[model samples]
Target: MNQSSSQSSNRSLPDSEYYRAFLDRDSNYDGIFFAGVRSTGIFCRPTCSARKPKLENCEFFATAQDALLAGYRPCKRCHPTDHPGSTSPLIKELITLVESDLTRRWKDQDLRARGIDPTTARRQFKSRFGMTFVAYARARRMGEGLKTIRSGERVIDAQIDSGYESGSGFRDAFSKMMGSPPSGNVAHTLKAEWIDTPLGPMIALADESALHLLEFVDRPGLETEILRLRQKHGLAILPGRTPITELLESELASYFRGQLQEFTTPLHLYGSDFQKSVLKILQQIPYGETWTYAQQSEALGNPKAIRAVARANGMNQIPILIPCHRVIGSDGKLTGYSGGLARKEWLLDLEKRRKS
Candidate 1:
């Protein structure tokens, strides 16, 4: 049974064939098998767009455990094992059924007719997706509705397109989620765009020169942030992207690869003056090096302000671009990071490997 399971869920390939796939770095093979490169001694999914290694310089493993057993670890992007566990056959069937009919919302009565327990199904789905099935379905339908409106369709056209018949019902939902009516306007004139990142999705807004907002998909207080932007600018942000989006994506990829030593692109910094000073000091720490809070405070010419430095570091608005991760605790521990300490360690290690 163990052997059969491995073969059925084979996420990796043999060393010889794995090298070929690794050389390609194609998205088609991602999440199947984890590939470990002998050259860098790093394991990654096939879709990792980072620079490919030579055929002979790569190794492969079927599972993350196998990779780690052979002295490799998990890759960040693709989040190989980050998904929820496989559901029961019935839940799988329910998911498949709902997926087939995206135009129509699945209701509890529909599940009862199929002899499925709606409450149990709801719990299982929420356990995996962090939201109830109905919530996700509603979000999906709303996304479709938004797309239709963006394409110059009438409000009623968009509502019907999303499987909703009542315009008022749709209007209430839109206002609750996005804080405005159906129009996805931004700046009364400025543009906004959505780009997928390794961590999650980012909704970025920019002008001709600088990127103003780059919020993560699951950022705490994200809804509050959006409302703040709307009230301050007298406009609404829609899901969209501009030409500079491509530049930001490329540079972020490079930064992940340790190829980028600094972010030269214009950044519209937002934060208190103390936070700004701390962030600037963080940038000067250089790639692959680090500083403690006490060290950072000393550099700021206020040796007694170590706690203030730490607090300021916590509020650094721009993460990777500002390089607040280069600041650790005086105890040499990887300290607080808004993006999580694991990511902080990962970035620091990535930079160190590049210096090597």
Candidate 2:
């Protein structure tokens, strides 16, 4: 493949065109190029709300790495390193508020009291997290209560700490979330944490030791995937972080920064033996490399199982770590990716750029 063409495609538009988009704060231009402000020595997405730099002071680059290589730091306000157009300011604010008070029962009235429109909050949260803001807060509260109960606190105290006034109410909510009533003796729990990346926001589900699932938050059927994981493992998945998740988050940060190539975070594969073998092969795919489905199938010692290999690739739960995005069509074109083809392209571009 012509690597020069690939680089050119990423920045096909002329500088004048990019400058116009930068001036307009066009969301469409986001991730297409980053604008580095010469005066401020910072790079930002086209949709960055920070005051625009003068035309003479602006320089454009195809990727965040390019901007950094040009000696420009990322803009703190716009977070150009994050996935362009994936998160909104409101979502960030609400997440911060929820984190600040995990035990707070957030009602629609409470949202209004905080000068946030409840409907907007619900819409934005649903769009970003596949759940409404209220649901997200409730899950957080339940997680906090679970942590308290696991620490040997009385059930009543746990309920009160979760802002539930009545034991029955707490039990009902807990049962709905956990598939059963909580108990102090409960041994296994899965924690879910949201991870932001240059491609998008991803949801990570893990226990104390190993990561179980990781997928882009906007991936189709993500909620169903979480439910299936809960049912399959018979574990209550809560909105919290575990040691594995913390490690994965740090690894992802480094990965996106082009400082890490191999992911060493432990993972627990939940699939049939055949599917597990397929995923293992995906990991063996070298960084900054591409493989056809036929190649993967052959690597699995089943040359005729190309279609089966593709099916297993589709079922992969972990993306970048498993490197499913590295698999392409025999025709040398991109194929299906759970995170969307655009993200798939971005990841490939990022790897290739870093490798070069």
How well is each residue in 311-345 modelled by candidate 1, as lDDT tens digits? 88876656777788898877799998876687788
lDDT of model 1 at position 97: 72
Q: Name the top lDDT candidate.
A: 2
State, as a TM-score between 0 and 1, how close model 2 is to the true structure. Answer: 0.54
- How much is the lDDT of residue 129 in candidate 1? 41
Error of 1 at 58 (Å): 28
lDDT of 1: 0.59
Stretches > 4 Å off in candidate 1: 1-161, 164-190, 233-235
Off by over 4 Å in 2: 1-181, 184-187
